[model samples]
Target chain A: MSDNITKGKMIKPENLVYTKSRVMTDNVTSYCPGCGHGTAHRIIAEVIEEMDIQSEIIGVAPVGCSVLMYDFLDLDIQQAAHGRAPAVATAIKRLMPEKFVFTYQDDGDLAAIGTAETIHACNRGENIMIVFINNGIYGMTGGQMAPTTLEGMKSSTSPYGRDVATMGNPLKMTDIVATLPGTYYVTRQSVQKPANVRKTKKAIRKALEYQKLNRGTCFIEIVSNCPSGWKMTPVESNKWMEDTMFPYYPLGDFKVPEED
Target chain B: MERELRLMKGNEAIAEAAIRAGADGYFGYPITPQSEVLEYLTMEKPHERTGMIILQAESEVAAINMVYGGAACGKKVMTSSSSPGISLKQEGITYIAGAELPCLIVNVVRGGPGLGTIQPAQSDYFQATKGGGHGDYKLIVLAPASVQEMADFVELAFDLAFKYRNPAMILSDGAIGQMMEKVWLKPQKERSREFPEWATTGKTPDRERNIITSLNLDPNKQEDFNHKLQAKYREIEKNEVLYEEFQCDDAEYLFVAYGTSARVCQKAIELAREEGIKVGLLRPITLFPFPTVIISRLADQVKGILTVEMSAGQMVEDVRLAVNGKIPVEHWGRMGGIVPTPEEAVENLKSKIIGG
Candidate 1:
C-alpha cells in the first residue's frame, strides 16, 4: 500500500504519468511497464533539452514504436517509411548540411529492412545522428523474432527459442557499424539502471554535439528491455537485460574519432 | 538579344541551353541518342568558380537521385537520358514528385516496349503523360518538336517547374534528339521565383529546422494533402497549356501530332496545301495539359482529324475524347523504330478526310 512498492508496479497510477524531466509533450505514452523505449525516449528528450538544440534539431522517426514520436517531440520531426529513415535522413542532411539531423530506429528497422540504406548512409559519412534501439524482438508486431533476437530467446515466432545453428547468429549492428570509416562515433549503452541511463544520456548528448559540429556519422545503440514480449514482470525484465543481453551485447563505446 | 547561331543536335542543344539557362548542376548518364547531352556538357567548360556541377553518374537512377538531392537544396538541377535509361529513373522521379521538388528531366525517347531499337519513335507518350511511376501524379510533359523548341523549352520547362514546384519533362524522340538544326541561345538571368522560405536550407542562428517529407499517416491530413496536390494541378492546367496551330483557321481536316511527329506533320501541311486540300496541324507543346480546348474547338470546324504519330496511336485517344464523337478522329502510326514520313502523314490525312 506504500508509495515505493506501488510506484514502479504495473497497477500504480502515478507510474502512468511520464517524467517531467523530459521534453515530451502531453501525449500519452503507449508503452507497457518496463518497456525500455520510454526510458530511451526520456533520455533523448532530456539530452536535447540540456543541449538547447531543440529549436534546430530535426529527428527522423522510424516505423516501429517510435513512429509516433513526431507527436511527442517538441521539435521538427520527419516520419520515414519502415527502415528507410537512414535514406530519408541522408537526403535531408545532404540538402541542408547545417541542420542537426538524427534518426531513431528499432532493431528491425535498422538491421533488417533498412540494412542497405543504414550501411550506405554510414559509409558516406553523412553528418547525422542515429539512436538505434535494440530490444531483441519486434515488440510492435507481437513479439516476432527480430534480427537482433538473442540465441535461445523465446518469442511468438520462435516458440522453442532462437537456435543459432538454424536461425543464424544475432546481428551485432554496433560492431558492424564500427568497422565503417565514415562512422565517427559508435557506442552501445543499456537503460537497465539509473546510472546507465545517465551514461546513455551523456552518450546521446555527445553524439548530437558531434553532429552539430559537422563531425561525421554518430551512432548510439541502446539495449532495452521489453517486459510484455519477454514474458517477465517489469523487475524481472530489467534483471534479464542486465544478466543476459548486456553480456552478449556489451555496453561501451566502440569507436570515436579524434577530437577537433 | 540575339546570340550566336549554331547548328546543333537536339541533345547538344538541350545541354548547352541548360548551361545558358543558369542551371547550377547537371547530373546525367550517357545513353544512345542522348549521349550528346553529356558530351556537350563535358566538352564545353562553363565558368567553374560559380559551381556549375556536371557529373556523369554511375547510373540513371543515381543521376535523378542527385537531381533530387540538389533540387531539395534550392539548386537548378537537371538530368537527361534515352528511353531505356529513363526506365531506371522512374523511381527517383516518383520520389521527387512525392517530395514536390522542382527539377528537370529530359528523355530522348526511342522505339520501345523494351530495348526495341535506338531509332526514333514516340512510344513513351503514355509514360510521359499518365504518371510513369505509381501513384496519382503528373509531370509537366513538354514535347519539343524541333531543335529551336529544344533550346527554348529547356528554360521554359525550368521556369514552369520552379513556378509550380513540380518536375518538368522535355519528351523528345531520337530524330529530334540527334538531327542538326539552327538555334539562338539566350541566358536565363534570374530564377522565376525566389527560393521559398520553407526550402530545406540549414537553420540559421535564429530559425528552427526545416524538414521536407511526404509522410501523412492521419487519413484526414492525407486527404488534405491529396486535395492540395489536385488544386495545384488544376492551376497548372489553367496556366501552362501550350500548343501551336498551323493553318487551322478555316481548315476542314486537321492533323494532330507532337514532338518529332509534329515536324513531319508540318511538312505534310505544306504538301496538302499544294494538293488543294485544306489540311492544318495542331501540335501540342505541353502534352499533359493536352490542349483539349483546341481539339474541342477544332472538332466544331473540322469534319475529320488524323493523328499522325511515330508509334502506336496514343494521343489519338485524347483527341477522340476531346472531340467527344462529334468528328471522326482516326489514328495512323508506324511502330518499332520507323519514322512516318511527311508523305505518309499526308496520305493518311487525305485518305481519312477525302476517302471518308
Candidate 2:
C-alpha cells in the first residue's frame, strides 16, 4: 500500500481505488497458503462492510480450519462444536430475529458430522445464512476423506485413492439442500480467479441481503482448494481446483428466489 | 393477575415457573417423566402471553446446544430432560460450564445404566456432583423434593446460575416430576433485557465485540481459565450450601437424604420417633455444595448416620467423605427403580446399625 501510494499522485480519500474492509482485523489469518478460507473471510467481511451491518451481524465458526475466525473478523462470533454451527446459528437467529446470523463451516463439518444439523436447520426454514466451504477433504485434521471427497481422490486416510465402492461417492450437498423447500437461495461458487472472486462477492451480498426479507436459509457453498492438504503448491492447487474440483462441484446457483 | 395457588404436577410447575420468572427462552426435547414440562409450555402459549421463545429441538443434543446459544446472548434460558436425555446433554453442559455461561438444566431422573426404567431413581448423583461432562467443572445442583420446591427452584436456579455465571440443575426424579401438589405461584416478573457487558448482544461502538467460546488454544491460558472456574466453584461452596433440618434437635441418630429419598426419610423419622429412637432427618437441597459443613457438625452429635437413596447409595459416598469417619456412616438403598417404603428404610437402619 505504501509503495503504490509513493508512485501515484497524492492520494485523497475519494481517489483511493481500494482498501481492506475495516470489519477485518489486523491479525494475519492462519489458513494455509492457497486455502480458500482467507478469501471467503475477506468476501464476507467486505459484504458486511458494504451493507454496513457489521454491528448487527453475528457469525458462528465451526471446529475446522476457520475455528479462529473470531480472531480475524471484527464481529461477534460463537464457536460451535464440529458440525453443530447450523444448530447454534438457528438458536441465535431465532432469539434475535432482527440480527443477521450465519455459520461458516467446511465440508467435513457440514456434509459429514453436521449433516443432521445442516439438513434440519434448513428444513425448518431457519432465517440464517450458511457459508459452506467444500474443499473435498478435511484440511485441519491431516487431510482425511470427507463426505465430499471426490472419487479417486487420495487422502491420508484414503491412501489407495477414494474407491467409490468402499469410500462412497462424493456428496453434492448444495444440490440436496437446494431441493429443500426452506432454502431461499443456494449457490455453488469459487474464488480461484479475479472474475470468480467478484462473482462470489455478489453471491454473498445477495445471500446477506435476503436475510432482510425474512426469507428462509440462504446457503452458499464455496467449492474451495486445500493446497497443503492436497499436497500441491498454491498455484498448482488453484489450477487443480479450477480443473478438477469445479467440474464435479460446478459453480452456479442451484436455487434462487423468483425475480421480483 | 395476582399470584394464584393451583394444583399442578412437578413438571408442569417448572414450565409455568420458568415463564413467570421472565425466562427469555425454553429449548428442550420430549423425554419420559419430564415430557410434561415441554408439553405444558407449548400448551400455555407463553409466546403470546410473555413473548418467550419456545422451541422443541431435534434431539436432547440439539436442545442443549440451543440453550447454549441463547445463554451466550446472556438471556435467561433453560432445558429439561430425563436420565438418558440428560446423558446426551452432558457434552453441551460441559461446554456451557467451560464458557462460564449461565443456564438452567432440569433432570427428571429415571432408572439408568442403559434405559434401566422410567421409574424414579437417584442414580445420577455422582454424575451431577462430580461433573458429568468432560472437564473439571461443577453445576450448582438443586434437589427438589416436592412440586412446590420444583416450581420455586426454577427461579432460584436461574438466579444462582447468573450470579455465579455457571450452569444450575434441578435434579429431581420421576416421582417428584410426576406427583401433583398445590403450589402458591410467585408473581410474574418482568422480562429483563439487561445483560452483562460480556454478552454477545451485537457489538456497539462503545464496547469491543464479545466472543462466547471456551476454546483457549494456549495451554497456560486454558489453565488460567480453569483456575478461575475453580475459584468460582469454591465461592459457591462457601455461600450456596442449603439443607433442611427436621426434628434434628435432641436427636441421637441422623438420616442424610435428598430429593424423594428425603421425603421418604421424613416419614421414617416419624416412625422411629414414635418408637422413641430419637431419629432425625437432614435433607440437602443443594447437592453440589453437598451441605458438607452441616453434615460434619451433625456427624459429631449423632451416634450413627444412615444415608438413604433411591439408587444404590450414590450420595452416601459424599456423606462418608463429609463425615470423615467421625461416627459410623452407612448406606441403605433400593435399586432397580424400587422406592423403599418408610418401614423398609427403618427396618434396614435397625437391623444394620441399631441392633445387628
Docking class of 2: medium
Listed for every candidate in order, the interface RMSD values in angstroms are 4.5, 1.0
Q: Write the per-residue lDDT of candidate 1 for residues B1-356, one digit (tens) a residue.
A: 23669899999999888888888778788889789999998888653523366766556765676676667666788999989998878877877787788889999999988888999889888888888987778899999988998999999999898888899999999999999999888744543244566554444445544555566668898788878878888898899899999999979899999988888899999998999989889999999878999899999998899998888899999999999999899999999889989999888887776697
In model 1, which runs have C-alpha deviations exceeding 4 angstroms? A1-48, A54-56, A61-65, A79-88, A106-113, A134-177, A190-196, A212-215, A223-251, B1-49, B52-99, B114-120, B174-182, B188-195, B202-211, B350-356
The CA lDDT of each predicted structure is 0.83, 0.91
lDDT of 2: 0.91
- Cα lDDT tens digits, model 2, B66-178, are 88888888889999999999999998899899989999999999998888899999999998999999999999999999999999999999999999999999999999999
Q: Write the per-residue lDDT of candidate 1 for residues A1-260, one digit (tens) a residue.
A: 88977655866655565455545667777788778888888888888777776766667778787777766666666656567677657655655566788889999999987787688778878799999999899988889999999999998988999999998889999999899998999999988888998899889888888887787899999999889889899899989988999999999899976783
Off by more than 4 A, model 2: A1-12
Q: What is candidate 1's CA lDDT for residue B81?
A: 92
Tell me how far the alpha carbon of residue A238 in candidate 2 is from the true structure, in angstroms, after superposition.
Answer: 1.5
Candidate 1: residue B96 Cα off by (Å): 4.4
